[model samples]
Target: MASSGSAEVERDLTRDIRLEVSSSNRSSCQVCKEKIEKDSIRVAHPSRSSNVSIMKYVHPSCYLSSCVHFENSKCKSKCRLSKHEIGKHELRLTMALTSCEGKLKDQVFFHPPHASTLVRQLLDAAGGTEHTFDQLCVSLPQDAKAWARDALSGVDLTGRRAPTVEPEVKPRAPKKKRAAEDDEAESAAKKPRAKKAKASSEYFVEDGDPFCDGDQNDGDAELVD
Candidate 1:
């Protein structure tokens, strides 16, 4: 059982709308029509990396089979839904519900941030919305607490709450120096310094180019020799 404080924190942190409906539509997943919604569930998967889907709810049965991180023969239950979302999809799976006056507003899906926008668009094509973040985080799912525990690797859920922000403090302005003295200092600093050393005035005596055999000597000195 979660404490009242942690419970509220968990709710706020994971607030999202979740729904369970019995659709006689019997529609198999459009991605794979092999299974029917009557016996299967439909869910959203992010089309690309790092972008979450909004209102793109996935089906329960479909999720178990088609998850990218589908494991064989170990854990095959609906309880592992959050695990699939966190582990398989770089996107998160949040069950945030919207509300007006702290009451039911609507139900929607939240994909992980890493998933592409197109995934959400695809979901919207079927069933989705464009609700804002504040509109979200109202009705979070219970799954988030457990999944956060497992995925977050056991960070304490105790005492987690909405952060109380403090008022901002502005910095003080810099002091102005005395004008006459500052000007004198500035002018003195800007004066150029004397040269440290002059380059050597000596120049090397030239020899005939040795690159060509035609002129192998220094200006025909070898020819004279």
Candidate 2:
């Protein structure tokens, strides 16, 4: 009856706590992407960009690790962010160029990926059949991750994609430092130009051949005669 039930209830509570403690044990190293069982550590929220796939699980440590690169910088380098709000607007500038030079000149970077490991998660999330990456891009928009998912659904195979770029064809070579120095010197030699003159260019006459005028020729002949 109620006599020993109190003790039994306490025992049941103890067992439940122990089981929960054991069940939640996971020892995955988020940074290195390794799993450890006994020495498992709990990672808090990580610094993963929204531009990634859901399948790409980073330990809280791993995700937070890369945020320094992603955060807005006052004088940032070229990346997700930059000095003058480079990445502030967050636009993905993509261009297709077959030649390596063209791609390089355009600063375009392209990489492929693994099918089974990298893409399946993205495809599964997007609800696209495994062959509609480009078509789905319209609705999905700019996330690298969404694009990756679309690509996964579209491609038959996957692995780390290689980077192949068309080199940019420079209409002109980058101005050499030495040549720039010369230009600087020339500019320094000349005084800074005054502000735009109020007078129209009409003040400055064009080069004209005085001899071309019939009146000048006739006057010369008469003088010679």
TM-score of candidate 2 to 2 decimals? 0.22
Question: How far out, in Å, is residue 220 in model 1?
Answer: 40
Tell me each candidate's TM-score: 0.21, 0.22
- The numbered model that scores best in lDDT is 1
Question: For residues 1-225, could you state the per-residue lDDT of candidate 1 as single tens digits?
Answer: 879999886754343223234355554442345544553334533221245433333454333223222111221222222323222222243332223354422222222332223233333333434332212222334433343323223234456431122335789655565667788899999999788898889755556554434534365454443
Off by over 4 Å in 1: 1-19, 37-58, 64-147, 150-156, 159-225
Q: Cα RMSD (Å) per model? A: 21.9, 23.0
Where is model 2 more than 4 Å wrong at Cα?
A: 1-113, 116-118, 121-151, 154-165, 171-225
In candidate 2, position 74 carries an lDDT of 26
Model 2 root mean square deviation, Cα atoms? 23.0
Candidate 2: tens digits of C-alpha lDDT, residues 37-71: 44333223212246541222233333223211111
